[model samples]
Target: MYEIFEQLLSERGVTPYRVAKETGITTATLTSWKQGKYTPKPEKLQKIADYFHVSLDYLMGKNSSLTTCPDCGFTYDPSYPEDIETHIEQHTAWEKAVKEFGEIYSDGVKCEQIKAENRKISHDLSLPLEERCEAQIRVLRCLFSRSLVANSYSLDHVPFDTYVAMMLNNPSYRKNNLEDDLLQALIDKYGTASGMNSGTIYHIPNKSKAISTKDKRDIKRDLDRIMEQLSNQEYGPAAYDGEELSPEAAELFRDELEIALKRLKLINKEKYNPHKNKK
Candidate 1:
């Protein structure tokens, strides 16, 4: 019984000293309870149980579940929901997909194919309970990534990866559509990973994968090309147009374009060139 109380305390992030201080139970008494040296008095047990939102039966190990469910096969949580068969089914589906798709690609691939793979492996494959939980998380993460890419234009101020992870972890997050409740939970957890407005997230397309560091390099290359094109446009046409801009027009253009030029200069100055600075 006291062992149960100790487990609950750890789960709730409560220190024995804190519990002792709050309940006016002595440190030695709490220590004894933890070591199974003494069972707590009824009133003390009640106080501890109430504080932890656990039943006395749970605290005393009379019942194994922290919250009992008749249908759940397990006596303990495995980091996924119990009493919900869908959770287990989801794990099974993910394991099937993994066996079919290989490691990284399993999550990003099409669900129908994944489901098919799951069918193929249905007779031969069996994951341990912990591995099943991890597989579910992977599938969920992939699904979330795809959803974010689909709606990236509408989303505001959310990092692409965090948003995807949040949606996957949330049980009530709907498939094929972003939910406000899920978004709110994301905001709460990540506290605005982007600078954009909150409501704008709805317009963004969901992405299938996170923006890799290599992708950032590609984006930078594209931007550099655009900058070159713009610079050539601003300066090259004088040689091509068969006439140079008048001094006054050129001066006006330079002044008007000063902000953009400065921006380009900043980008050039800060750009990280891996080839040039090899370790």
Candidate 2:
């Protein structure tokens, strides 16, 4: 029992004095236990067990047959030798996944460990469409699971990758989004951020101006909606369109206003690689 106790202390890089301080047990009592002078009462033993997060029986050698995996915190009976081998193998797999790809931490939806590979996969157009979709979903899942959001939460098919990447990298962006309840509570608390107040964001060109977090989040929300509208195969509205001006027909009028800027190449050449002749 003392051996197991010392092993846990060694594994956690803590000392008996620290444990005594934290658990409110006296150093003298620990010394007495160590010197084989006395056994601690069940109540005291339970406190130590709780601190270490192990079963009291295991701590006291009452369950000497049981073994706990240090990495995965899985406890099982070593007496079941055949099953123990299989269980150990499973723990190895999970431990590797957690260390390599990162798991959601307990505090929030922040995936500090979200790998660059996952981010690259989200936007790499050359990959299979399915792969890209999975990458995006995985990123959100990492966020949601880590943050303890429910499984039914919605991102409304928005490019959450954009918001998530920024949120993770930038403290201001993340705080604003959380305070807005922007992406995590997408379905119940509010609809998708992308579909709300979109037109207003377009003209707010001073995005760099100092503003409150909610204001910044609102601007981000509406901009995403604009991108959504342009890319989707649909048109739905006009601010003053009760007349016979169907928006579909109104769209054709855009062509009437379209003109080739013959100076386009001149501007690009002037800026990028001005021709020797200054074409």
Candidate 3:
């Protein structure tokens, strides 16, 4: 118990002194706990748990309940009733999806031939911007040898494992529509809000997990905003006029995409996934 308390303090980057100051747990009380002279009462444990935005069970040294689903690879706890419900549901969906949509696993491999070609392209430094963009996309396809080839020609090159699917932020309706099954699968995989707050956490939108609106309004709103932002977007010669995009520019684009995705209700803002139903 004392070890768990110490771990919490350490993980939060706070000293026992700071914890005492902020949580109003006296130094003597904490010291007693540290020495294992006394077990912390429920009230004290509650305060500490609340301070960490965690559960009392967690403060009492309970192990995380999360386990990875074999089919979807999403994490959820069987202990939580809600998790068990959604767990079985998603697993079933994914089991069916495997046969229906097929699978594209991400295996990070670089062929020597492709690697040399990429190197040659980089070393040459005189390729047209359009050419470079095309080359980079090709590189994307090559790296993910099992890239999905069903959808759009260019987009088929964009492969995904669970992580990549989790981070999908394409604002284009064409991309989203083409990748409808993919998005649905993601929603199905990380669908439950059961283990979010008090159990194991999965970072995703409240709107996504426990759906607030059955209408799915947020998705449409976000799509509209994305369309507005990228109203005239098209295939470009390069990421920039004549050079690869600058880090700042790239970061800004990422930020915009993240904001849109979250607003679109595909991500969560906090460690506590409090939302309760699926969108």
TM-scores, each model vs. reference: 0.24, 0.25, 0.29
Estimate every model's Cα lDDT from 0 to 1: 0.46, 0.48, 0.49
Q: Alpha-carbon error at 17 in model 2, in Å?
A: 0.8
lDDT minimum window of 10 residues, candidate 1: 197-206
Q: Which lDDT tens digits does candidate 2 get at residues 1-279?
A: 678789879866799999999999998998899988988888988898878766677688774465555544445565333335545554664455354444433223134455345657756768765566556556555553332212111122123333344334444434433322223432332223332121111111122222322232334445445434543446654322354345565454333322212233234434553223321
Could you tell me how far off, in angstroms, the CA of residue 270 lies in candidate 3 after the best superposition? 26
Best by TM-score: 3
Model 3 segments more than 4 A misplaced:
64-257, 260-279
Q: Which ten residues in a row have the lowest lDDT in candidate 3?
A: 149-158
lDDT of 2 at 151: 14
User: Could you tell me the TM-score of candidate 1?
Assistant: 0.24
Determine the C-alpha RMSD for candidate 3 after optimal superposition of all C-alphas: 22.4
lDDT score, candidate 1:
0.46
Model 1 RMSD to the real structure? 24.7
- The sequence of per-residue lDDT tens digits that candidate 1 reaches over residues 1-279 is 666667777766788889888878888888887777787798988787766765566666663443222321112332222222333443444444334333322233354455444433322236443343334444444443344334321123234355544444444443333335434444454443322222212223222223422233344455556544544557564321454555565555455555455555445534642222331
Which candidate number has the best lDDT?
Answer: 3
Per-residue lDDT of model 3, residues 1-279, tens digit only: 788778878766789888778888899999988888987778988888777766676677787577775545446654344455555655554455455444522222334466457645633447654455444334433433322211111221222343233233323322423234434444454332222232111234333334332113344456556544453345542254455555576556657765666554544433434453443
